[model samples]
Target: MTTLNHYHYKRLQEFCSSVFVKAGVEKEQADIVAASLVQADLRGVDSHGVVRTAIYLKRVEQKMINPKAKIRIEKEDESTALIDGCNHFGAVVGDKALKLAMKKAKANGVGMVGVKNSNHFGTGAFYALRGLKEDLVTIVMSNASQTMPPTGGIKPFIGTNPLAVGIPCGECEPFLLDMATSVVARGKIIVAAQKGEAIPHGWAIDKNGKSTTNAEEALKGSVLPLGGPKGYGISMFIDIFSGVLTGAGFGKYVNNMYENWKAPQNVGHFFITIDVNKFMDIKTFKHRMDLYIRDIKTEPKAEDVEEIFIPGEMESRRSEQRKKNGINLSQNVQRELTNIGMKYGVSLKDALMLNHNTEGKGV
Candidate 1:
């Protein structure tokens, strides 16, 4: 059976940073990538966390992706810009794009940035939350490798295509929404398969187009869209914004990094940052948001439901708890991490020793 272990989050982040540096990535770029991955883990989005780092480094090692890529903006207006990532690590590209969006918003009330020639940027929420920290409403989205189909068709075509939005709420936790257009991110299926677990019904189908609980089969087949055709449309628009509009590969053309070793995945990203003061003062907006949250929470009671949660509330709670206690890693994932560390002459065991390890309840 797949087992679990808990390790201190800070130490884990340090270990990840060191691994990338050893893999020949510049320290600044490596740290940004490492933080983004660990942030995913801390928020319990393990599918996008350190587990995926090994593949990223492998891509770097093969020269399919450039670790020291020159990220530059090819075009811009007062509040909008288009960036060429030069095929760098997605997290580094995302970091620069989000910060630029925030800077423009602060000066011009709103900012929008389009990115091209990037790799997989861990999670949209990572950038969204960064903007949220500056008290701006943020929207982040990306088009990924196609592993899903549109409404009724069979062959894989559309990507999971994730979207994330974060807004500040005065007294309450910010309302955060981050989701994949697919029923689940494809990485989750990869994780389940690694752990020898079956996926839940309605998540994906076999190659023959039949719904199946088999994770391996699901990987070979297509993951179902989030709300059937509705999600298909959403994903299509995301691809338009992130890929087509940004001059990056779209639809069937976006390279899957794992499958296509010939070149880097020309992924794309879109970000929007809005300064609330553009509409009303920050204090007034926060006060209204506080009341709005109260209205929603007061009327929420259903069978077996103890509390109502905002879209990203659960993840925030998970992050807080994990930060205090520790993050859990399945034995399968832990082994993958250790194996990667060994290649870089780093010891995962020593990384864990920074904080005492403990047996924990497995997910």
Candidate 2:
């Protein structure tokens, strides 16, 4: 097999969902997980995409994730609520939580929800985009197993702790910002290690605490916090909001989804939804947002910069391109997916092989 090949997103999603169902996940939930993973691939964030399916399946096999676990609200107020994920897949928990927030926001202009006992929810932007569907602005954040160290420290304590925001811009697509507090998401390092690729300097250090470009060494060590202490500070608040505040795992207490076979991850997430009409007329808000984005993007470019992209614009473009042209899956990821599919009785060749005439045509 070559180093890379293109696959239709729908085909990939169906393959993933089938594998999940064969492994005993309900059909609806399986679709949710599959869509979330494919959404990552579509947006060029392959780190959170289908490459994660192997680990996700392993967690299921080990009973670390409850495929049919119930998601329920534990407490609530007009504009605030707390929900328990029941150790379900992270995307499932996030979907329900974000929807609940949206429901509340529709009624009260603003809604906030904290989630507990969740598993690794994929990209936060998945939920952010959900908010965009309803013309709402949403913020989504989550804390993962510790992989980044606090500034000036060698030992890992805080998670990369990702944050994402989606802002509706009316006629244009929503403005999206999604990122990890660490210089790079740990999943990217994992992907590099899987592909035998080296990471760039300043991304991480070896377990020995020396900066290293080797992905495996970086995995053994810790990814660097973005901007040093500033990134560390942002991580603290993310943990506070998505973890501590939710009464879920926090600091170093969250179990690792990869290493901890004895228990559920109990990961946590926080979501905030704002309804545009509640604050201003929808027309005015959209017009103002257009002006705001234009003002920032049309400014003078930095040295050698040809264009400036608003937050999430690049990803949105990547998504549209991938939708028209298929997604790329590395050989290593393909092998793993094939192996897992075989275990579940799905034909990898049938699922991945594409007809040339339909290639990159969103088949």
Q: What do the candidate models score in CA lDDT, each in turn?
A: 0.89, 0.89
Give the distance in Å from residue 124's predicted Cα in candidate 2 to where it truly belongs: 0.8
lDDT of 1 at 167: 95
- What does the lDDT read for residue 305 in candidate 1? 90
Model 2 over residues 247-286: C-alpha lDDT tens digits? 9999898999888999898899999999999889878998
Model 2 TM-score, all chains together: 0.96
Candidate 1 Cα outliers beyond 4 Å, as residue runs: 1-4, 353-363
lDDT of 1 by residue, 92-204 (tens): 99999999999999999999999999999998889988888899999998998889998998778989999999999898988899999999999999999998999999999
TM-score of each candidate structure, all chains considered together? 0.96, 0.96
